[model samples]
Target: MHKIAMAMLGVALLGACQDNNVMPGPQDGRALFMANCAVCHGADATGNGEMARAMAKPPKNLTLIKVRHGDTFPRAKIMSIIDGYARSKTMTGPGMPEFGVLLEGDLVPFDSGDGIQTPTPRKLVALLEYLESIQAER
Candidate 1:
């Protein structure tokens, strides 16, 4: 099927880039980005990838987050956008799909001083870190 072919292609591409600047880590944020985001965000996170060309609304310029938010990176907002917790205004269509289940890993607990706590997914954290790393300098 198409999904199977795409998965195979992704593995091949990841293998091809193993020797490049993609750093190795327990989480390997760059690998995650390349696997899940590069098709739409481009390998450099410039938002001009081929998928963006096909979209009615071009993908966001991922590199400019810092510039857009007054030189302060909005971690919560970025994560929300990625997991579909929040919808970004720039996305005029359903071009960006929710990767919530794909981004889920071990649950992490966080308390907001209320009677309850929320568990955050680890892969989401890794993806957020990857996005933060690629932000353009202000």
Candidate 2:
């Protein structure tokens, strides 16, 4: 099957990048991004990856998220976008596929600095934290 072949290819690529043959930690955001996202979003989180040129719509220049959001990095909002809750059903699978698959993991208390703690997924939080750290000053 195509999926099986892709899985084998993925394993080979990952193995070539490691020293101890260990997988990246589930909550290691930078590792997560480089492995899963850099192909489309670029290692620096810019929208300049090689695949971007082939797509009908280029990926977002992620460093400007805070600038576009009025100088505040909206944590909950970003998480929704990442996990696909922000996308309508009709809007799925083209420009962006549903990453709600990322939601299927452990949860931890996350405060959006809003005085309320949400039971957020650790993986989502890790990725979100990494994105926030890369905000370009505007």
Candidate 3:
């Protein structure tokens, strides 16, 4: 009886661990962005959030990302910027805080279609999808 109880408890614990590994989907992206970025990027992601009003410089208009990048969304650049690995010249002190820790999660492999696989966090990928979906059609 003791062994059976212990086994059942182990199985329950294992199931809980598995639940934590479940990857976030694209649908979760908007909520994550709202919670983490809306202060400066705005609810509509137009760079006019309430926080931007208090800053010395207004945040970049995220909707224009593709338009500014010659009609191609710069995924790598966006990821780097979010992770604080790359900082744009236009960015000043504390304009964008690093979100690496918040974005870190299960790495889901994606084929870049150039013979290289990109191991990206599920959260980051979802966030990217959300950003792409919100790009202004110009």
Worst 10 residues of 3 by lDDT: 108-117
**Tens-digit per-residue lDDT, 39-100, candidate 2:** 77898889987677777778899999999989999987887888777865654324766566
Model 2: lDDT to the true structure: 0.76
Tell me which residue pairs clash in candidate 3: none
lDDT of each: 0.72, 0.76, 0.77
- Top lDDT model: 3
Determine which window of 10 residues in candidate 1 has minimal summed lDDT. 18-27
| Count of backbone collisions in candidate 1 | 0
What TM-score do all the candidates reach, one by one?
Answer: 0.68, 0.71, 0.75
- For all predictions, the C-alpha RMSD in Å is 9.9, 9.1, 4.2
Which is better, 1 or 2, measured by lDDT?
Answer: 2
Error of 2 at 9 (Å): 31
Scored against the true structure, residue 127 in model 2 reaches a CA lDDT of 82
In model 2, how many backbone clashes occur?
0
Please, what are the lDDT tens digits per residue for candidate 1 over residues 8-81?
99999997775432222334567777878889889888997768888888888898998999998886678678
Q: Distance (Å) between predicted and true CA of 39, model 2?
A: 1.3
